[model samples]
Target: MKDDEPEDTGSTLPRRQLGRLLREAREATGMSLEEAARLMEWGKSTLSRLERGKSERVRIRDVIGLCELFGTDEEKTAAIRELAEQAPVRSWWRSYGDVIAARFNTYLGLEAGASELAIFQPLIVPGILQTTDYARTLDRQYFSRDTDEELDRRVGIRMQRQHIITRQRQPVQLSVVLHESVLRTTVGSRQIMAGQLRHIADLSTRDNIQVRILPFRAGFPAGIVVSQFIIMSFPKDSRGKPVEPTVVFAESFTGDVYLEETGDVRRCRETFRTLQRATLDDRPSRDLMREIAREHDSER
Candidate 1:
């Protein structure tokens, strides 16, 4: 395989990858799920659910057992084990369970394993990079059942998700474009907004993260519809094909919609390019953020 060839990280879905890897290893050894379950002393149905990625959670012990039973080579075993370790203990957005929302959890799952993310946030800051204060303020305004604890939990998860950028192995490339309105709008108090803007300025300095701001001067473009969405891409598989379909996630007040068809993907890419053309470049965007911060400080 070429040095840049993407390994079959098992499942295209991050949450399901571990289970799929385990199943593949077991089957390669010509063992049935029941046989593997017996070797591991786990219930057959439990093993089956994991293989199907239907389980809500994955256990480390189960991963170790499957690895041993299948006698998987070191590389494959290590990859599967890593996925098992990286799996979230619970859905990050579970705190918002009472809210009527889309299946954002699935999106989060896919994002966890994505190689790159291109985001266009026309209304507000992207959730993964929002500071705690901004997140809490936005959550309170949007969610009716909000509480201090829930807000804190959600914000904490958002912060944790940012670690995907700094993680040792394969860090995700993040390119984000925010509307100029996002910088001008104060979601929280003046002090909080200033801090948030400063945070954005600092984050833009990171090598793996790119930030741009779309100016209002670029009036109603074809892409400036009422919707906001993100496009995610993963590394290609052994056959030089994307393991999972590239997805466009569009969010509404009521719920979210995911588009995976070829035409939709093309449209999303074209819209993103148009939005990029409308945006200020990175240096100017950071300058704009700093300027906003100064304005917020002066108002106080």
Candidate 2:
């Protein structure tokens, strides 16, 4: 099999993992895709798309039918159905066409579907939580030549993406550790920075989100600096293994980086833990946020 081929070991995309499970169950019952589709009253193409991960969407009722047809255990049936429900929702980001780089979108899709996300940002706020004004200010300062329309659209996409934290039945659990300088840095006007700090404070109170600050006093124990990365973990599958190996996303000036190998994940996780240890707890972080807000108010 090709290196990128979906593994039957259950370490793959949700759809691919589900497909492999379905294939296993069907074969155990000596049923083909056509036979199974017919038994479930689904179109042949529908089953084909599902098996290929081209269409990962499925209803609980359909899962029930498959379970009954294949005589699958209730546990397996439940896990498969959950994967279908947890498939990443299609978003307007898709409309960006080729403008948004593929690596970025791939990470976004993983973020949208992740049950939990952990990030360590040394220089800036995590993108999903960045305020529109802050995002625009950063874009303007960095890309002065870019048209206003382009900037606005980028900011709009970012705001929409933030919904991943708020709109879901169980909002994605987010734990972010940002460097202390991020709070002190004036990305926008003084007023905007103050507003941004207050916003961060508000978001930290959210039940599913936690924000911490890593002070410079911690020094560079990990031998890394000025890098931001996120780790996404998917819900488990029928076999009780994580659906996909954790994916690490790192951004650069010109393009992005995606790390899926085991060694990279281990190093990123270690770095995250190291940063976590150096950071203030959530309560203290909130206090720092309020302090910044007060400073902004005083300057005003």
For model 2, the stretches where C-alpha displacement exceeds 4 angstroms are 1-104, 143-147
**lDDT tens digits, residues 5-25, model 1?**
333333334456566677768
Give one digit per residue, the lDDT tens place, for model 2 in 86-172.
444221122222333421244656776677788888888878888999999988877688799989987898898889888758888
TM per model? 0.68, 0.67
The CA lDDT of each predicted structure is: 0.73, 0.73
Clashes of each: 0, 0
> Which clashing pairs does model 2 show?
none
The total number of steric clashes, by the backbone 3 Å criterion, in model 1 comes to 0
Q: Which residue pairs collide in model 1, if any?
A: none
